[model samples]
Target: MSQGKQLPEFENEDDLAAWIESHDTSEYMDQMIEATDEIEVLRTRFSTKPLDVRLRTEYLEAIEELAERRGLPYQALVQRWLLERLTQEAPDLMTK
Candidate 1:
């Protein structure tokens, strides 16, 4: 690492990620340090299976428009709606 060049402070992960995306890490290799303390890692796994459903063109277009407005994919919006309805109809099934 160059003595004159120092790592810039980032306000958040997005800013750090942006900086890292544009810059070369090899330049800062000397400054990088490995963690010496013990660390615990916890991971959660979710199992999902794909389901295909057919819908009319008009309904699909409407769903896509609504999903775009809500900043979510149309498929995700549909999944959410299905989950909501299922929860309403069978709350006990959702607990499992």
Candidate 2:
């Protein structure tokens, strides 16, 4: 590998991502390290399971229209509404 310039230290993943997005990674090829170490991957807190709920066509259409106006998927809007209601009703249950 060529003696390329050293990589800059980033405070967080966002900074590293921004740097990589703006710069040519080819220059940092020599500074990169192989991922041989075994790392534990933790499950995400927002992991979701498939839910099957039957809703009336009119309600579904209204939800789809609202979600479209808000630039979000209908299911995501529904999830957000549900979470919001849950938080309002029982804030303790919503705690991580």
Candidate 3:
């Protein structure tokens, strides 16, 4: 067994993710403080980064049309569709 170190304050999920990628969960899981009382969170937000990709203009226009019908921004529609596809084809990608 390895000695566990104190977990640091994470600024965001991305920061915590970077730490997890380099550290073994077993090494730190045991060091966590036990919950003595109920904890409540007021809000939840996901951190996102800008991703630029080139696509065929026709496909982009079609996406825009579909998004418009759904009253959503094209980018949001694309993200939703991509997430749905990833869930089916590559769930591991979602976790990472």
TM-scores for all candidates: the values are 0.53, 0.52, 0.51
Model 1 CA deviation exceeding 4 Å by range: 1-43
Of the two candidates 1 and 2, the one with more favorable lDDT, higher being better, is: 2
- Candidate 3's residue-wise lDDT over 44-74, tens digit each? 6878899999999999999999999999999
Worst ten in a row by lDDT for model 1: 26-35
The local lDDT score (0 to 100) that residue 56 gets in candidate 3 is: 97
Candidate 1 structure quality by residue, lDDT tens digits, 17-56: 9999999877676776766998899987889899988999
Query: How well is each residue in 1-96 modelled by candidate 2, as lDDT tens digits?
Result: 677688899999999999999999988888888879998999777666999999999999999999999999999999999999999999998867
Residue 42's lDDT within candidate 2 is 97
Highest lDDT: which candidate?
2
